[model samples]
Target: MELSQKRFVTIICTYIRAVNGVYGGAAHDAHVWSLSNERQYMPSNYQNGDKSSWLIGDSGYPLEPWLLAPYRNAEENSLESLHNEKFTKAKSIIERVFGILKSRFRLQYAPKKVVKILNVCCALHNICLIYNVEAPTVIEINEERSNLALPNVDQNEFSRIAQTIRDRIKISLRS
Candidate 1:
């Protein structure tokens, strides 16, 4: 579900999955941002090479990436470590939630029967809270899931943009 303001309440009874992290249900709000917009806004506040800027987070739960601007001026050594620790710990709940959905609820795998798919997804969803079993890897992502490694994008343009973002951030810190 696409939310404009806040997503504290959007995490119930939905797929709870994120795709490319652009648009998704539930936990996606933490890291979701339009590069189109952020590219314009963040540069003014944060230097591109500022690794700290990458951590500016509005996740509410303290587990998400710190929003670039805030992260730039944070306690990099200790706070980053603490934030990472908390983020790792907090992510387990989401993982378990997906695990239950896939294993007990059987949502991860595709249903073969056309007539009973809805019924099955619904029934399993209810029973899942009680059964809580191993996640059944039912639905496998196609080329879509593994695209990060393949790099189908235009290398030159992508590199140029990345370098620009990096250079700009780096230059900002010198002042």
Candidate 2:
């Protein structure tokens, strides 16, 4: 799902599975879906090094030429620290969007027909956004599930290219 930081709106959503699904299951791995689905239509501008249009995501997301993720590990006062701070601030907007979803739709305990219900909720959310309806003041809380083991993504040519892009981004941030 995509969220607009400026508008507090859900920009795009693709249902994979319920929150109860296995952490590393095909439906739950963000990187897998991203590679197969969203990566296909990445714009030529981003591919040609236009950072302005890139997507920013958390560590759970794979670092790609068109996606920016915070540094995984960094020393105090390091460039990575500054990058991570900025990245986290930007990502927090999505976190609030999720909270709004849970509050307005009770997504955590959504009953049978999970995907269908979630999709409907997302559509309704967008409608509410369009109408400028006030979001529920009481945001629901959902604990994050445990981290899953890394999936066996192949370290092939694309991975190498993505890594190179990430390295350049890190260096640029440092400078």
Scored by TM-score, the top model is 2
Give each model a TM-score: 0.30, 0.64
Tens-digit per-residue lDDT, 117-137, candidate 2: 655677677787778899899
In model 2, what are the clashing residue pairs, if there are any? Answer: none
User: lDDT per prediction?
Assistant: 0.35, 0.53
**Model 1 lDDT tens row, 14-33:** 34322222233333343344
Please state the error at residue 112 of candidate 2 in Å: 4.3
Score candidate 2 by TM-score against the native.
Answer: 0.64
Q: lDDT for model 1, on a 0 to 1 scale? A: 0.35
- Kindly report which residue stretches of model 1 are placed more than 4 angstroms away from their true locations once superposed: 1-76, 108-175
